[model samples]
Target: MDIKLLVKLTSRAWALDILAHLHRGVPGRQATLLAATGAGRTAFGASLQHLMALGLVARNPGHGHPLRPEFILTAEGKAAAAKADAILRAAEVSAAGLLRKSWTVPVLALAARPQRFSGFKAGLGAITDRALSTSLQRLEAQDWVAREIDLSERVPFPVYRAVNAGGEISRVAEAAV
Candidate 1:
């Protein structure tokens, strides 16, 4: 989703992980934050600065013994997270494709049966012939899927099949279904 946490964080990957961890009830502790971020102590401090400056996180003071700092989302931070959630939900609604997050269902469907052009179109749901062809071609180029050119008559038909079988997209497709 559109968590501006993504926009605010220094590295998109770490930012996303941190926000997701928080959303899942992981409280922000220094050691855990470092682990979650995959950041060295020095880098972690820089990241924390960004998070704080963005108003998405703050130091939780009460829990510390010798003044150790526990990081937490401020109200504004939570609001941003919520907004991100809403943006993600809205995208799923509008695009009818959450494949970016979870391609499991679609990936499985494709894997279970790589299809000829017609069948592929039907399975993918309401894709235009041109877009469908383009996507198939692109997937073929990426080696994620293969297209065997079928030619017996006037037109060329291609049957698609999974190449990697279990990449990120495949996992997402599998999860979706």
Candidate 2:
């Protein structure tokens, strides 16, 4: 699982949503997936093609019109989709929403290594304080990140680390990058 591959999968618009929807084991047809994911034809087509290229998904042979194909997860796709489902279930965040945010995955990666607020901001470079704060708060709210107060110094400071969910996300992201 190359980190770059994970990032590539997550970075595409509506890619995670498509995977998550498929993971539910419901309709695997084009129309149903479009309705479930609310993705337009172009985005859905591109994503499906990308998934197929990665061997994560495939068209069911002779299942539908060539113009409107039915899809199924390949063996590798099932495993990856299972991991995606687990990530969503554990984080309580929509895959689409999580991946759409610019700093979410990077912040998760940094938090996985345990860092203070300043460190996170610095590592991300050019991200405003408000953005960093908001990203951290979102992760914390989802229980993916744990924040602790460091009191060793005269004035205490807070540090953040990835919880189990965050760690999983980090692993996924690291492998992709």
Candidate 3:
């Protein structure tokens, strides 16, 4: 997926979780998805709406009760869902919370190689320094990203690389984009 779309997907709470569950073949009903993702009703509804607005998901026509709607992945959604599933599988369960953060996926995706802070800032475009720092720290804390000090120059600087699960996620994000 593209970085912009990936950022949009991860920005909202429960959006990634919803996509992952749906990709796993969980029924796309509100209740079923809520149960599977363990998201609160309000957040779940918002994420579902966001997906619909993105044209990745849609309500099934002529199906189910009016009060109980069923959702399905659009052609675009299936590809996105597949990517979401791959990302979820690549991440450790403990990393789920990080995945929900706005900059996490975008940062990881950009960290396909060891990059400096400026590189990330330039790549992500709108990401602020503090936000990028925080995202990198969180990913580092999760051990998905590894920070190495580069002393090759007069001044040493830190370089971040996606390691382990982060590496896997980066690969998935970079795929077909």
| lDDT for each residue of candidate 1 in 30-100, tens digit (9 for 90 to 100) | 78767754656775576567667777878786775455677788886775554433333322333223222
Q: The CA-based lDDT of model 3 is what?
A: 0.87
**lDDT values of the candidates?**
0.52, 0.75, 0.87
Q: How do the residues 1-177 of candidate 3 rate in per-residue lDDT, one tens digit apiece? A: 688888888878888788888889999898999999988899889999999999999999998799999999999999999988888788888767878888888898889878999999988888888999999998998988999999999999999999998999888776724
Instruction: List all candidate RMSDs to the true structure.
Output: 11.1, 4.9, 1.4
Tell me how far the alpha carbon of residue 69 in candidate 2 is from the true structure, in angstroms, after superposition: 0.2
On a 0 to 1 TM-score scale, where does candidate 2 land against the true structure?
0.64
- What is residue 18's positional error in candidate 1, in angstroms? 1.9
Model 2 ranges with Cα > 4 A deviation:
93-96, 106-110, 115-160, 163-177
Best by lDDT: 3
Point to the candidate with the largest TM-score.
3
Arrange candidates, best TM-score first. Answer: 3, 2, 1
Clashing residue pairs in all predictions, respectively, total: 12, 10, 0
Candidate ranking (lDDT, best to worst): 3, 2, 1
